[model samples]
Target: MDTTQTAVKLILDRWEASMHNYDVLLQSLSDDQLQKEASPGKNRGVYLLGHLIAVHDSMFPLLNFGEKQYPELTKIFIESPDKAVAELPSVQELRTIWSKQRTSLKEKVDQLKAEDWFGRHTAVSEEDFAKEPHRNKLNIILTRTTHLAYHTGQMIYLK
Candidate 1:
């Protein structure tokens, strides 16, 4: 494979591995366990899960893939702090959404060519992209992978 292909493969592989690790960690916890905070006064397991989903849902629009599948999640999970919302989707419901959203994102992302990964995402203006080429579609995956891993680490405290 050429350098671009190799780079894309490596980023995608790491992103997938991060997602898998998070899935395994979340699966190990029961629904009741997810209701507890990961640490005292910190975000709950369920809140973290919803927050991750909300962030990932925004990626569709940012990456120019499509509109967000769960725009409502942004208000609850992203805009509001953990207990600020009066209610949240059940843990099981969040799990199902996570699974479906991740699968859909993977399908769309996997279909992109190597060059497509290097192109600017929708969030970047053309003039800015020319000046700052590093802000590309692949960078979103890299950053979001790190974001996932960080929250996954926090969720470990729940166990």
Candidate 2:
């Protein structure tokens, strides 16, 4: 009901729509076709989707000062052709994770204070000190959401 919640809800709505569009686009391809590389150098639709899911997981851990965690999306390697291929999540699995993450983000962002939104970090300058840190708001939804939409365009256009 408040401004933060409203903004968070809008981000969640956009993300949810992206899931539907991505799912529909993938569903159109045959199994073999889905596995086919969109380009010789580029990752397949499944890989792209996995990466997107991993990005969502990244956001939570990134909010911490310094930490790393393996995302369930792409913890396994698939190189050399002899190593076993990592399995993609089932469609239902993808939907469930995406839905849960969006809901969590919506709640977290709403509860976060204005100071939390305004983040401080050191500037990349010799003169800048710990005390002279730069500030930025965690207001990147429009830009990053646009990135997802752009990647979707690539998925839709791939042969």
* Each model's lDDT: 0.95, 0.55
TM-score of 1: 0.98
Candidate 1 lDDT, tens digit per residue, 1-159?
Answer: 999999999999999999999999989999988999988899999999999999999999988999999999999999999999998999999999999999999999988999999999999999999999999999999999999999999999989
Off by over 4 Å in 1: none
Question: What TM-scores do the predictions have?
Answer: 0.98, 0.54
Off by over 4 Å in 2: 1-36, 39-41, 64-70, 74-84, 121-143
Q: For model 2, how does the per-residue alpha-carbon lDDT over 1-159 read when each residue is reduced to its tens digit?
A: 888656656665785687567667766755555455566766666565555666655555544422223354546322212124545665455546656765665565456565565453222233542344333335444445676787677777554
Alpha carbon deviation, residue 116, candidate 1 (Å): 0.6
Instruction: Tell me the deviation in Å of residue 83 in model 1.
Output: 0.3
